[model samples]
Target: MNPTEWRTYLVTQESRSAGRETAAVVEAALSGGVDAVQLREKGRPARERYELGRRLRDLTADAGVPLIVNDRIDLAAAVDADGVHLGQSDLPAEIARGRLGDEAIVGVSASTVPEARAAAEAGADYLGVGAVYRTGTKDVPDETNGVGPERVAAIADAVDLPVVGIGGIDAGNAGAVTAAGAAGVAVVSAVTAAADPRAAAAELREVVGDGR
Candidate 1:
Protein backbone atom coordinates (compact mmCIF):
# COMPACT_ATOMS: atom_id res chain seq x y z
CA MET A 1 0.00 0.00 0.00
CA ASN A 2 1.15 3.53 -0.62
CA PRO A 3 2.12 5.24 2.62
CA THR A 4 -0.14 8.06 1.46
CA GLU A 5 -3.03 5.73 2.21
CA TRP A 6 -1.81 4.59 5.62
CA ARG A 7 -3.34 5.72 8.87
CA THR A 8 -0.82 4.13 11.21
CA TYR A 9 2.93 3.58 10.80
CA LEU A 10 5.16 1.73 13.27
CA VAL A 11 8.85 2.40 13.84
CA THR A 12 10.58 -0.38 15.78
CA GLN A 13 12.85 0.05 18.77
CA GLU A 14 13.50 -3.17 20.71
CA SER A 15 15.08 -1.49 23.71
CA ARG A 16 11.67 -0.08 24.61
CA SER A 17 9.75 -3.28 23.86
CA ALA A 18 9.67 -4.43 27.50
CA GLY A 19 11.56 -7.63 26.65
CA ARG A 20 9.79 -8.73 23.48
CA GLU A 21 11.93 -8.97 20.37
CA THR A 22 11.45 -6.35 17.64
CA ALA A 23 9.98 -8.82 15.20
CA ALA A 24 7.57 -10.12 17.84
CA VAL A 25 6.33 -6.61 18.58
CA VAL A 26 6.03 -5.93 14.87
CA GLU A 27 4.10 -9.13 14.29
CA ALA A 28 1.65 -8.17 17.00
CA ALA A 29 1.38 -4.68 15.59
CA LEU A 30 0.67 -6.07 12.12
CA SER A 31 -2.06 -8.31 13.50
CA GLY A 32 -3.53 -5.23 15.11
CA GLY A 33 -3.56 -3.16 11.86
CA VAL A 34 -0.37 -1.25 11.22
CA ASP A 35 -0.22 -0.21 7.57
CA ALA A 36 3.57 -0.03 7.41
CA VAL A 37 6.59 -1.03 9.50
CA GLN A 38 10.09 0.45 9.83
CA LEU A 39 13.10 -1.45 11.19
CA ARG A 40 14.96 1.15 13.23
CA GLU A 41 17.45 -0.62 15.48
CA LYS A 42 19.99 2.10 15.91
CA GLY A 43 23.48 1.33 17.34
CA ARG A 44 23.18 -2.42 16.78
CA PRO A 45 25.88 -4.11 14.74
CA ALA A 46 25.22 -4.19 10.99
CA ARG A 47 25.03 -7.98 11.00
CA GLU A 48 22.56 -7.96 13.87
CA ARG A 49 20.35 -5.39 12.22
CA TYR A 50 20.51 -7.28 8.93
CA GLU A 51 19.34 -10.45 10.68
CA LEU A 52 16.49 -8.56 12.31
CA GLY A 53 15.63 -6.85 9.04
CA ARG A 54 15.42 -10.22 7.35
CA ARG A 55 12.95 -11.32 9.98
CA LEU A 56 10.95 -8.13 9.61
CA ARG A 57 11.01 -8.31 5.83
CA ASP A 58 9.42 -11.75 5.95
CA LEU A 59 6.80 -10.73 8.48
CA THR A 60 5.78 -7.59 6.64
CA ALA A 61 5.73 -9.39 3.33
CA ASP A 62 3.37 -12.07 4.59
CA ALA A 63 1.17 -9.39 6.09
CA GLY A 64 1.24 -7.40 2.81
CA VAL A 65 2.59 -4.41 4.69
CA PRO A 66 5.50 -2.28 3.54
CA LEU A 67 8.77 -2.62 5.43
CA ILE A 68 11.00 0.46 5.56
CA VAL A 69 14.56 0.40 6.82
CA ASN A 70 15.46 3.47 8.78
CA ASP A 71 18.46 5.51 7.63
CA ARG A 72 20.12 2.67 5.77
CA ILE A 73 19.68 2.30 2.04
CA ASP A 74 22.21 -0.50 1.82
CA LEU A 75 20.45 -2.49 4.51
CA ALA A 76 17.12 -1.84 2.85
CA ALA A 77 18.50 -3.29 -0.34
CA ALA A 78 20.17 -6.13 1.53
CA VAL A 79 16.92 -7.14 3.21
CA ASP A 80 14.93 -6.43 0.07
CA ALA A 81 12.84 -4.09 2.16
CA ASP A 82 10.07 -2.16 0.43
CA GLY A 83 11.70 1.18 1.20
CA VAL A 84 14.00 3.39 3.25
CA HIS A 85 13.40 6.28 5.62
CA LEU A 86 16.12 8.93 5.61
CA GLY A 87 16.87 11.47 8.29
CA GLN A 88 18.27 14.86 7.32
CA SER A 89 21.69 13.60 8.29
CA ASP A 90 21.36 10.55 6.06
CA LEU A 91 22.01 10.42 2.33
CA PRO A 92 20.10 12.75 0.08
CA ALA A 93 16.70 11.53 -1.12
CA GLU A 94 17.65 11.77 -4.81
CA ILE A 95 20.60 9.49 -4.09
CA ALA A 96 18.35 7.09 -2.19
CA ARG A 97 15.84 6.91 -5.03
CA GLY A 98 18.63 6.55 -7.54
CA ARG A 99 20.26 3.68 -5.66
CA LEU A 100 17.03 1.99 -4.59
CA GLY A 101 15.55 2.39 -8.07
CA ASP A 102 12.28 3.95 -9.21
CA GLU A 103 10.04 1.30 -7.68
CA ALA A 104 11.38 1.83 -4.18
CA ILE A 105 9.62 4.04 -1.67
CA VAL A 106 11.83 6.83 -0.38
CA GLY A 107 10.85 8.79 2.69
CA VAL A 108 12.51 11.73 4.40
CA SER A 109 12.31 13.06 7.93
CA ALA A 110 11.46 16.75 8.18
CA SER A 111 10.55 19.09 11.02
CA THR A 112 9.67 22.31 9.27
CA VAL A 113 8.01 23.66 6.11
CA PRO A 114 11.33 24.37 4.40
CA GLU A 115 12.59 20.92 5.20
CA ALA A 116 9.35 19.35 4.03
CA ARG A 117 9.43 21.26 0.75
CA ALA A 118 13.06 20.37 0.26
CA ALA A 119 12.32 16.71 0.80
CA ALA A 120 9.43 16.77 -1.63
CA GLU A 121 11.65 18.41 -4.22
CA ALA A 122 14.40 15.93 -3.37
CA GLY A 123 12.21 12.96 -4.47
CA ALA A 124 10.74 11.75 -1.21
CA ASP A 125 7.69 9.54 -1.56
CA TYR A 126 6.55 10.69 1.84
CA LEU A 127 7.64 12.79 4.80
CA GLY A 128 7.95 11.81 8.48
CA VAL A 129 7.50 15.15 10.19
CA GLY A 130 7.82 15.67 13.87
CA ALA A 131 8.76 15.09 17.37
CA VAL A 132 5.21 16.41 17.62
CA TYR A 133 5.10 16.11 21.36
CA ARG A 134 7.71 15.85 24.05
CA THR A 135 9.25 12.38 23.65
CA GLY A 136 11.68 9.91 25.14
CA THR A 137 11.93 7.67 22.07
CA LYS A 138 15.38 9.18 21.54
CA ASP A 139 17.41 12.04 22.91
CA VAL A 140 15.30 14.65 21.12
CA PRO A 141 16.16 18.16 22.18
CA ASP A 142 13.55 20.32 23.93
CA GLU A 143 13.11 22.54 20.86
CA THR A 144 12.27 19.71 18.50
CA ASN A 145 9.78 17.95 20.71
CA GLY A 146 6.44 19.60 21.40
CA VAL A 147 6.39 21.44 18.12
CA GLY A 148 2.68 20.51 18.14
CA PRO A 149 -0.07 20.05 15.53
CA GLU A 150 0.72 23.47 14.19
CA ARG A 151 3.93 22.11 12.81
CA VAL A 152 2.03 19.32 11.11
CA ALA A 153 -0.36 21.85 9.64
CA ALA A 154 2.44 23.99 8.35
CA ILE A 155 4.38 21.16 6.81
CA ALA A 156 1.32 19.49 5.38
CA ASP A 157 0.40 22.73 3.69
CA ALA A 158 3.91 23.17 2.39
CA VAL A 159 4.33 19.79 0.79
CA ASP A 160 2.26 17.60 -1.51
CA LEU A 161 3.66 14.31 -0.33
CA PRO A 162 2.04 12.27 2.42
CA VAL A 163 3.07 13.36 5.90
CA VAL A 164 3.40 11.01 8.86
CA GLY A 165 3.71 12.74 12.21
CA ILE A 166 6.20 10.93 14.44
CA GLY A 167 7.58 10.92 18.00
CA GLY A 168 5.54 10.64 21.19
CA ILE A 169 2.28 10.03 19.31
CA ASP A 170 -0.24 7.67 20.91
CA ALA A 171 -3.97 6.94 20.63
CA GLY A 172 -4.86 9.81 22.91
CA ASN A 173 -3.07 12.37 20.75
CA ALA A 174 -2.53 10.82 17.34
CA GLY A 175 -5.86 12.29 16.32
CA ALA A 176 -4.44 15.78 16.62
CA VAL A 177 -1.71 15.06 14.13
CA THR A 178 -4.07 13.51 11.62
CA ALA A 179 -6.60 16.20 12.26
CA ALA A 180 -3.94 18.68 11.35
CA GLY A 181 -3.70 16.94 7.93
CA ALA A 182 -1.11 14.22 8.32
CA ALA A 183 -1.71 11.15 6.18
CA GLY A 184 -0.65 9.01 9.17
CA VAL A 185 1.08 8.94 12.54
CA ALA A 186 4.24 7.01 13.40
CA VAL A 187 4.88 5.79 16.92
CA VAL A 188 7.61 3.92 18.78
CA SER A 189 6.77 3.42 22.46
CA ALA A 190 3.06 3.79 21.87
CA VAL A 191 3.07 0.25 20.57
CA THR A 192 6.52 -1.23 21.16
CA ALA A 193 6.43 -0.66 24.91
CA ALA A 194 2.76 -1.42 25.40
CA ALA A 195 1.77 -4.40 27.56
CA ASP A 196 -0.24 -5.59 24.55
CA PRO A 197 1.28 -4.32 21.33
CA ARG A 198 -1.58 -5.61 19.16
CA ALA A 199 -4.27 -3.94 21.19
CA ALA A 200 -2.23 -0.75 21.37
CA ALA A 201 -1.92 -0.73 17.60
CA ALA A 202 -5.60 -1.54 17.15
CA GLU A 203 -6.66 1.27 19.45
CA LEU A 204 -4.30 3.62 17.68
CA ARG A 205 -5.62 2.48 14.32
CA GLU A 206 -9.13 3.28 15.38
CA VAL A 207 -8.04 6.67 16.65
CA VAL A 208 -6.25 7.50 13.42
CA GLY A 209 -9.24 6.39 11.38
CA ASP A 210 -11.50 8.56 13.46
CA GLY A 211 -9.01 11.37 13.25
CA ARG A 212 -9.35 11.44 9.51
Candidate 2:
Protein backbone atom coordinates (compact mmCIF):
# COMPACT_ATOMS: atom_id res chain seq x y z
CA MET A 1 0.00 0.00 0.00
CA ASN A 2 3.00 2.25 0.18
CA PRO A 3 3.52 3.87 -3.22
CA THR A 4 7.00 5.06 -2.23
CA GLU A 5 7.98 1.40 -2.13
CA TRP A 6 6.73 0.73 -5.68
CA ARG A 7 10.01 1.09 -7.53
CA THR A 8 8.63 -0.38 -10.76
CA TYR A 9 5.01 0.38 -11.63
CA LEU A 10 3.43 -0.84 -14.87
CA VAL A 11 0.47 0.86 -16.51
CA THR A 12 -1.40 -1.53 -18.82
CA GLN A 13 -2.51 -0.79 -22.38
CA GLU A 14 -3.25 -3.75 -24.63
CA SER A 15 -3.00 -1.74 -27.82
CA ARG A 16 0.65 -1.11 -27.05
CA SER A 17 1.40 -4.79 -26.28
CA ALA A 18 2.49 -5.82 -29.78
CA GLY A 19 -0.78 -7.71 -30.39
CA ARG A 20 -0.52 -9.67 -27.13
CA GLU A 21 -3.38 -9.82 -24.64
CA THR A 22 -3.33 -7.39 -21.77
CA ALA A 23 -3.30 -10.30 -19.35
CA ALA A 24 -0.30 -11.75 -21.13
CA VAL A 25 1.62 -8.49 -20.83
CA VAL A 26 0.80 -8.30 -17.15
CA GLU A 27 1.82 -11.91 -16.59
CA ALA A 28 5.22 -11.14 -18.04
CA ALA A 29 5.58 -7.94 -16.02
CA LEU A 30 4.67 -9.77 -12.82
CA SER A 31 7.33 -12.37 -13.52
CA GLY A 32 9.74 -9.55 -14.25
CA GLY A 33 9.02 -8.35 -10.69
CA VAL A 34 7.05 -5.21 -11.28
CA ASP A 35 6.24 -3.68 -7.92
CA ALA A 36 2.67 -2.76 -8.90
CA VAL A 37 0.25 -2.71 -11.86
CA GLN A 38 -2.38 -0.26 -13.05
CA LEU A 39 -5.18 -1.38 -15.40
CA ARG A 40 -5.54 1.53 -17.82
CA GLU A 41 -7.43 0.25 -20.85
CA LYS A 42 -9.11 3.44 -21.81
CA GLY A 43 -11.81 3.52 -24.63
CA ARG A 44 -12.85 -0.09 -23.97
CA PRO A 45 -16.39 -1.00 -23.05
CA ALA A 46 -17.12 -1.24 -19.34
CA ARG A 47 -17.94 -4.95 -19.46
CA GLU A 48 -14.78 -5.69 -21.35
CA ARG A 49 -12.69 -3.69 -18.93
CA TYR A 50 -14.41 -5.31 -15.95
CA GLU A 51 -13.77 -8.82 -17.21
CA LEU A 52 -10.16 -7.93 -17.91
CA GLY A 53 -9.88 -6.38 -14.49
CA ARG A 54 -11.16 -9.63 -12.96
CA ARG A 55 -8.36 -11.56 -14.63
CA LEU A 56 -5.79 -8.91 -13.67
CA ARG A 57 -7.01 -8.80 -10.09
CA ASP A 58 -6.43 -12.52 -9.77
CA LEU A 59 -2.94 -12.30 -11.29
CA THR A 60 -1.77 -9.38 -9.16
CA ALA A 61 -3.34 -10.79 -6.01
CA ASP A 62 -1.50 -14.05 -6.48
CA ALA A 63 1.73 -12.20 -7.18
CA GLY A 64 1.22 -10.16 -4.00
CA VAL A 65 1.32 -6.91 -5.98
CA PRO A 66 -1.20 -4.12 -5.86
CA LEU A 67 -3.49 -3.68 -8.90
CA ILE A 68 -4.80 -0.18 -9.47
CA VAL A 69 -7.63 0.72 -11.86
CA ASN A 70 -7.49 3.91 -13.87
CA ASP A 71 -10.30 6.49 -13.76
CA ARG A 72 -12.99 4.06 -12.70
CA ILE A 73 -13.81 3.62 -9.05
CA ASP A 74 -16.78 1.34 -9.79
CA LEU A 75 -14.65 -0.86 -11.99
CA ALA A 76 -12.02 -1.01 -9.28
CA ALA A 77 -14.70 -2.01 -6.76
CA ALA A 78 -16.31 -4.44 -9.16
CA VAL A 79 -13.04 -6.23 -9.72
CA ASP A 80 -11.85 -5.78 -6.12
CA ALA A 81 -8.72 -3.92 -7.21
CA ASP A 82 -6.18 -2.56 -4.75
CA GLY A 83 -6.93 1.06 -5.65
CA VAL A 84 -7.78 3.70 -8.27
CA HIS A 85 -5.66 6.29 -10.10
CA LEU A 86 -7.45 9.38 -11.40
CA GLY A 87 -6.53 11.95 -14.00
CA GLN A 88 -7.12 15.64 -13.40
CA SER A 89 -10.23 15.53 -15.56
CA ASP A 90 -11.58 12.51 -13.71
CA LEU A 91 -13.34 12.38 -10.35
CA PRO A 92 -12.02 14.38 -7.47
CA ALA A 93 -9.82 12.34 -5.14
CA GLU A 94 -11.93 13.11 -2.07
CA ILE A 95 -15.13 11.78 -3.61
CA ALA A 96 -13.29 8.75 -4.85
CA ARG A 97 -11.93 8.17 -1.35
CA GLY A 98 -15.42 8.54 0.06
CA ARG A 99 -16.76 5.81 -2.18
CA LEU A 100 -13.75 3.53 -1.92
CA GLY A 101 -13.35 4.23 1.78
CA ASP A 102 -10.35 5.60 3.63
CA GLU A 103 -8.35 2.42 3.27
CA ALA A 104 -8.23 2.54 -0.54
CA ILE A 105 -5.05 3.81 -2.19
CA VAL A 106 -6.19 6.83 -4.20
CA GLY A 107 -3.79 8.58 -6.57
CA VAL A 108 -4.16 11.54 -8.94
CA SER A 109 -2.19 12.71 -11.98
CA ALA A 110 -0.29 15.97 -11.73
CA SER A 111 2.35 17.77 -13.81
CA THR A 112 3.13 20.86 -11.79
CA VAL A 113 3.71 21.95 -8.22
CA PRO A 114 0.25 23.53 -7.94
CA GLU A 115 -1.50 20.39 -9.19
CA ALA A 116 0.62 18.22 -6.92
CA ARG A 117 -0.07 20.39 -3.90
CA ALA A 118 -3.78 20.43 -4.68
CA ALA A 119 -3.90 16.67 -4.87
CA ALA A 120 -2.22 16.48 -1.47
CA GLU A 121 -4.90 18.76 -0.02
CA ALA A 122 -7.54 16.47 -1.54
CA GLY A 123 -6.04 13.55 0.44
CA ALA A 124 -4.52 11.68 -2.47
CA ASP A 125 -2.21 8.89 -1.34
CA TYR A 126 0.21 9.57 -4.23
CA LEU A 127 0.78 11.72 -7.29
CA GLY A 128 1.49 10.50 -10.84
CA VAL A 129 3.58 13.38 -12.13
CA GLY A 130 5.15 13.80 -15.52
CA ALA A 131 5.69 13.70 -19.08
CA VAL A 132 9.18 14.03 -17.71
CA TYR A 133 9.87 13.28 -21.35
CA ARG A 134 7.62 13.50 -24.42
CA THR A 135 4.90 10.82 -24.63
CA GLY A 136 2.42 9.46 -27.11
CA THR A 137 1.02 6.77 -24.82
CA LYS A 138 -1.70 9.17 -23.76
CA ASP A 139 -2.89 12.61 -24.76
CA VAL A 140 -1.52 15.25 -22.40
CA PRO A 141 -1.79 18.98 -22.17
CA ASP A 142 0.91 20.69 -24.18
CA GLU A 143 1.70 23.02 -21.34
CA THR A 144 2.49 20.13 -19.03
CA ASN A 145 3.81 17.55 -21.48
CA GLY A 146 7.53 17.06 -21.28
CA VAL A 147 7.79 19.07 -18.10
CA GLY A 148 11.06 17.24 -17.41
CA PRO A 149 12.89 16.21 -14.23
CA GLU A 150 13.23 19.71 -12.85
CA ARG A 151 9.43 20.00 -12.78
CA VAL A 152 9.33 16.64 -11.03
CA ALA A 153 11.80 17.89 -8.44
CA ALA A 154 9.70 20.98 -7.86
CA ILE A 155 6.52 18.95 -7.35
CA ALA A 156 8.23 16.49 -5.04
CA ASP A 157 9.69 19.34 -3.05
CA ALA A 158 6.31 21.08 -2.90
CA VAL A 159 4.08 18.12 -2.01
CA ASP A 160 4.20 15.69 0.89
CA LEU A 161 2.79 12.63 -0.93
CA PRO A 162 4.83 10.11 -2.88
CA VAL A 163 5.35 11.05 -6.55
CA VAL A 164 5.36 8.47 -9.34
CA GLY A 165 7.00 9.94 -12.47
CA ILE A 166 5.30 8.66 -15.60
CA GLY A 167 5.21 9.42 -19.34
CA GLY A 168 7.90 8.59 -21.85
CA ILE A 169 10.04 6.95 -19.17
CA ASP A 170 12.22 3.97 -19.99
CA ALA A 171 15.24 2.22 -18.50
CA GLY A 172 17.41 4.84 -20.15
CA ASN A 173 15.68 7.83 -18.51
CA ALA A 174 13.90 6.40 -15.49
CA GLY A 175 16.91 7.22 -13.37
CA ALA A 176 16.56 10.90 -14.14
CA VAL A 177 13.00 10.84 -12.85
CA THR A 178 14.01 9.10 -9.62
CA ALA A 179 17.14 11.20 -9.26
CA ALA A 180 14.88 14.23 -9.52
CA GLY A 181 12.98 12.89 -6.47
CA ALA A 182 10.18 10.64 -7.75
CA ALA A 183 9.61 7.72 -5.42
CA GLY A 184 8.91 5.43 -8.38
CA VAL A 185 8.32 5.30 -12.13
CA ALA A 186 5.08 4.42 -13.94
CA VAL A 187 5.44 3.35 -17.54
CA VAL A 188 3.37 1.89 -20.39
CA SER A 189 5.31 1.16 -23.58
CA ALA A 190 8.59 0.66 -21.76
CA VAL A 191 7.25 -2.73 -20.77
CA THR A 192 4.05 -3.20 -22.79
CA ALA A 193 5.42 -2.75 -26.30
CA ALA A 194 8.80 -4.28 -25.72
CA ALA A 195 9.78 -7.39 -27.66
CA ASP A 196 10.42 -9.01 -24.28
CA PRO A 197 8.41 -7.27 -21.59
CA ARG A 198 9.90 -9.25 -18.74
CA ALA A 199 13.43 -8.22 -19.59
CA ALA A 200 12.37 -4.67 -20.31
CA ALA A 201 10.78 -4.37 -16.90
CA ALA A 202 13.78 -5.90 -15.20
CA GLU A 203 16.14 -3.48 -16.89
CA LEU A 204 13.99 -0.52 -15.94
CA ARG A 205 13.76 -1.82 -12.39
CA GLU A 206 17.53 -2.11 -12.25
CA VAL A 207 17.95 1.48 -13.42
CA VAL A 208 15.40 2.72 -10.92
CA GLY A 209 17.20 0.80 -8.19
CA ASP A 210 20.46 2.53 -8.99
CA GLY A 211 18.79 5.93 -9.00
CA ARG A 212 16.97 5.30 -5.74
Candidate 3:
Protein backbone atom coordinates (compact mmCIF):
# COMPACT_ATOMS: atom_id res chain seq x y z
CA MET A 1 0.00 0.00 0.00
CA ASN A 2 1.10 3.56 -0.65
CA PRO A 3 2.31 5.29 2.49
CA THR A 4 -0.74 7.52 2.47
CA GLU A 5 -3.03 4.60 1.76
CA TRP A 6 -2.55 2.64 4.95
CA ARG A 7 -2.57 2.89 8.74
CA THR A 8 -3.92 6.42 8.76
CA TYR A 9 -3.53 7.53 12.39
CA LEU A 10 -4.99 10.83 13.47
CA VAL A 11 -3.29 12.83 16.24
CA THR A 12 -5.54 15.00 18.32
CA GLN A 13 -3.99 17.55 20.63
CA GLU A 14 -6.49 16.78 23.32
CA SER A 15 -5.70 13.10 23.24
CA ARG A 16 -2.16 13.82 24.35
CA SER A 17 -1.25 13.61 28.01
CA ALA A 18 -1.89 16.51 30.34
CA GLY A 19 1.23 18.34 29.31
CA ARG A 20 2.00 16.78 25.96
CA GLU A 21 1.27 18.37 22.64
CA THR A 22 -0.16 16.59 19.62
CA ALA A 23 2.97 17.25 17.65
CA ALA A 24 5.03 15.09 19.97
CA VAL A 25 2.71 12.13 19.49
CA VAL A 26 2.51 12.69 15.75
CA GLU A 27 6.26 12.69 15.41
CA ALA A 28 6.49 9.46 17.34
CA ALA A 29 3.68 7.83 15.38
CA LEU A 30 5.26 8.76 12.06
CA SER A 31 8.56 7.34 13.16
CA GLY A 32 6.75 4.09 13.90
CA GLY A 33 5.01 3.63 10.53
CA VAL A 34 2.00 5.87 10.78
CA ASP A 35 1.41 6.48 7.08
CA ALA A 36 -0.57 9.66 7.49
CA VAL A 37 -1.50 12.14 10.24
CA GLN A 38 -4.51 14.38 10.61
CA LEU A 39 -4.69 17.40 12.89
CA ARG A 40 -8.21 17.32 14.37
CA GLU A 41 -8.50 20.15 16.84
CA LYS A 42 -11.96 21.30 17.78
CA GLY A 43 -12.85 24.41 19.85
CA ARG A 44 -9.52 25.92 18.95
CA PRO A 45 -9.63 29.11 16.96
CA ALA A 46 -8.57 29.16 13.33
CA ARG A 47 -5.25 30.84 14.05
CA GLU A 48 -4.29 28.31 16.71
CA ARG A 49 -5.23 25.35 14.56
CA TYR A 50 -3.39 26.88 11.63
CA GLU A 51 -0.31 27.36 13.78
CA LEU A 52 -0.53 23.83 15.04
CA GLY A 53 -1.08 22.59 11.51
CA ARG A 54 2.12 24.30 10.42
CA ARG A 55 4.15 22.44 13.03
CA LEU A 56 2.48 19.15 12.15
CA ARG A 57 3.13 19.78 8.46
CA ASP A 58 6.80 20.32 9.14
CA LEU A 59 7.01 17.23 11.34
CA THR A 60 5.21 14.90 8.90
CA ALA A 61 7.11 16.24 5.91
CA ASP A 62 10.40 15.48 7.62
CA ALA A 63 9.20 11.91 8.11
CA GLY A 64 7.87 11.79 4.53
CA VAL A 65 4.28 11.20 5.59
CA PRO A 66 1.39 13.33 4.46
CA LEU A 67 -0.25 15.53 7.11
CA ILE A 68 -3.98 16.09 6.71
CA VAL A 69 -5.98 18.85 8.35
CA ASN A 70 -9.37 17.89 9.68
CA ASP A 71 -12.40 19.97 8.68
CA ARG A 72 -10.54 23.22 8.11
CA ILE A 73 -9.82 23.66 4.46
CA ASP A 74 -8.64 27.22 4.83
CA LEU A 75 -6.16 26.32 7.57
CA ALA A 76 -5.03 23.31 5.56
CA ALA A 77 -4.48 25.40 2.46
CA ALA A 78 -2.72 28.04 4.49
CA VAL A 79 -0.38 25.49 6.03
CA ASP A 80 0.06 23.78 2.63
CA ALA A 81 -0.52 20.39 4.17
CA ASP A 82 -0.58 17.35 1.93
CA GLY A 83 -4.38 17.13 2.26
CA VAL A 84 -7.60 17.67 4.15
CA HIS A 85 -10.17 15.30 5.65
CA LEU A 86 -13.65 16.73 5.92
CA GLY A 87 -16.88 15.76 7.60
CA GLN A 88 -20.25 15.79 5.84
CA SER A 89 -21.08 19.26 7.14
CA ASP A 90 -17.83 20.71 5.91
CA LEU A 91 -17.30 21.80 2.34
CA PRO A 92 -18.39 19.17 -0.18
CA ALA A 93 -15.68 17.22 -1.95
CA GLU A 94 -16.41 18.90 -5.28
CA ILE A 95 -16.05 22.41 -3.90
CA ALA A 96 -12.98 21.42 -1.90
CA ARG A 97 -11.49 20.07 -5.11
CA GLY A 98 -12.15 23.36 -6.83
CA ARG A 99 -10.47 25.19 -3.98
CA LEU A 100 -7.48 22.94 -3.36
CA GLY A 101 -6.92 21.83 -6.95
CA ASP A 102 -6.06 18.36 -8.19
CA GLU A 103 -2.86 17.59 -6.34
CA ALA A 104 -4.18 17.91 -2.81
CA ILE A 105 -5.48 14.70 -1.29
CA VAL A 106 -9.08 15.09 -0.14
CA GLY A 107 -10.90 12.60 2.07
CA VAL A 108 -14.49 12.56 3.24
CA SER A 109 -16.08 10.80 6.22
CA ALA A 110 -18.95 8.53 5.21
CA SER A 111 -20.75 5.93 7.29
CA THR A 112 -22.80 4.01 4.73
CA VAL A 113 -22.62 2.52 1.26
CA PRO A 114 -24.65 5.29 -0.35
CA GLU A 115 -22.59 8.02 1.32
CA ALA A 116 -19.36 6.33 0.37
CA ARG A 117 -20.51 5.98 -3.23
CA ALA A 118 -21.50 9.61 -3.46
CA ALA A 119 -18.23 10.75 -1.91
CA ALA A 120 -16.21 8.76 -4.44
CA GLU A 121 -18.26 10.18 -7.27
CA ALA A 122 -17.53 13.63 -5.95
CA GLY A 123 -13.80 13.04 -6.40
CA ALA A 124 -12.77 12.20 -2.84
CA ASP A 125 -9.41 10.51 -2.78
CA TYR A 126 -10.56 8.13 -0.05
CA LEU A 127 -13.20 7.45 2.57
CA GLY A 128 -12.80 7.82 6.35
CA VAL A 129 -15.42 5.26 7.37
CA GLY A 130 -15.97 4.81 11.05
CA ALA A 131 -16.32 5.17 14.65
CA VAL A 132 -15.27 1.59 14.07
CA TYR A 133 -15.18 1.79 17.86
CA ARG A 134 -16.32 4.42 20.35
CA THR A 135 -14.28 7.61 20.61
CA GLY A 136 -14.12 10.50 23.03
CA THR A 137 -13.10 12.89 20.28
CA LYS A 138 -16.34 13.10 18.37
CA ASP A 139 -19.24 14.55 20.33
CA VAL A 140 -21.89 13.37 17.93
CA PRO A 141 -21.01 10.62 15.53
CA ASP A 142 -22.78 10.89 12.18
CA GLU A 143 -24.26 7.45 12.61
CA THR A 144 -24.14 7.34 16.42
CA ASN A 145 -23.06 3.75 15.97
CA GLY A 146 -19.76 2.00 15.56
CA VAL A 147 -18.64 0.70 12.19
CA GLY A 148 -18.25 -2.95 13.03
CA PRO A 149 -16.54 -5.55 10.86
CA GLU A 150 -19.68 -6.20 8.80
CA ARG A 151 -20.21 -2.52 8.17
CA VAL A 152 -16.57 -2.06 7.33
CA ALA A 153 -16.62 -4.90 4.86
CA ALA A 154 -19.80 -3.61 3.26
CA ILE A 155 -18.42 -0.10 2.88
CA ALA A 156 -15.20 -1.44 1.45
CA ASP A 157 -17.22 -3.37 -1.10
CA ALA A 158 -19.20 -0.29 -2.00
CA VAL A 159 -16.37 2.19 -2.40
CA ASP A 160 -13.60 2.03 -4.96
CA LEU A 161 -11.12 4.29 -3.15
CA PRO A 162 -8.94 3.43 -0.22
CA VAL A 163 -10.87 3.26 3.05
CA VAL A 164 -9.38 4.21 6.41
CA GLY A 165 -11.27 2.81 9.38
CA ILE A 166 -11.24 5.54 12.00
CA GLY A 167 -12.35 6.43 15.53
CA GLY A 168 -11.21 4.46 18.57
CA ILE A 169 -9.06 1.96 16.67
CA ASP A 170 -6.13 0.71 18.68
CA ALA A 171 -3.34 -1.84 18.31
CA GLY A 172 -5.51 -4.42 20.00
CA ASN A 173 -7.97 -4.47 17.08
CA ALA A 174 -6.11 -2.90 14.17
CA GLY A 175 -5.58 -6.24 12.49
CA ALA A 176 -9.28 -6.91 12.59
CA VAL A 177 -9.91 -3.56 10.92
CA THR A 178 -7.53 -4.36 8.08
CA ALA A 179 -9.00 -7.83 7.72
CA ALA A 180 -12.39 -6.21 7.40
CA GLY A 181 -11.13 -4.55 4.20
CA ALA A 182 -10.01 -1.18 5.51
CA ALA A 183 -6.88 0.02 3.83
CA GLY A 184 -5.81 1.19 7.26
CA VAL A 185 -6.86 2.13 10.79
CA ALA A 186 -7.05 5.68 12.07
CA VAL A 187 -6.55 6.04 15.80
CA VAL A 188 -6.64 8.88 18.28
CA SER A 189 -5.99 7.80 21.89
CA ALA A 190 -3.90 4.66 21.86
CA VAL A 191 -0.59 6.17 20.94
CA THR A 192 -1.03 9.58 22.45
CA ALA A 193 -2.18 8.23 25.78
CA ALA A 194 0.90 6.13 26.25
CA ALA A 195 3.83 7.25 28.37
CA ASP A 196 6.26 6.46 25.60
CA PRO A 197 4.47 7.62 22.52
CA ARG A 198 7.08 6.26 20.16
CA ALA A 199 7.02 2.82 21.71
CA ALA A 200 3.26 2.88 21.67
CA ALA A 201 3.30 3.70 18.00
CA ALA A 202 5.85 1.01 17.33
CA GLU A 203 3.80 -1.58 19.12
CA LEU A 204 0.62 -0.48 17.37
CA ARG A 205 2.18 -0.59 13.91
CA GLU A 206 3.58 -4.00 14.67
CA VAL A 207 0.08 -5.22 15.36
CA VAL A 208 -0.97 -4.06 11.89
CA GLY A 209 2.07 -5.68 10.25
CA ASP A 210 3.76 -2.36 9.71
CA GLY A 211 6.43 -2.35 12.44
CA ARG A 212 9.03 -1.05 10.06
**Reference-based TM-score of each model:** 0.98, 0.99, 0.92
Q: Could you give candidate 3's per-residue lDDT for residues 146-188 as a string of tens digits? A: 7686787899998778888877788888888888888777777
The list of candidate 1 runs beyond 4 A from truth reads none
lDDT of each: 0.94, 0.93, 0.79
lDDT of 2 by residue, 29-101 (tens): 9999899999999999999999999999999999999999999999999999989999999999999899999
RMSD of each: 0.7, 0.7, 2.2
After aligning candidate 3 to the native by TM-score, how far in Å is the CA of 133 from where it should be?
1.4
Residue 118 displacement (Å), model 3: 0.7
Give the C-alpha miss distance for residue 9 in model 3, angstroms.
2.0
Off by more than 4 A, model 2: none
Tens-digit lDDT string for candidate 1 (1-212):
79889999999999999999998999999999999999999999999999999999999999999999999999999999999999989999999999999999999999888889999999999999889998888877687788899999999988889999998899999999999999999999999999999999999999999988
- The segments of candidate 3 whose C-alpha lies over 4 angstroms from its true place after superposition are 1-4, 210-212
Q: Evaluate model 3: give its TM-score.
A: 0.92
In candidate 2, list every pair of residues with a backbone clash: none
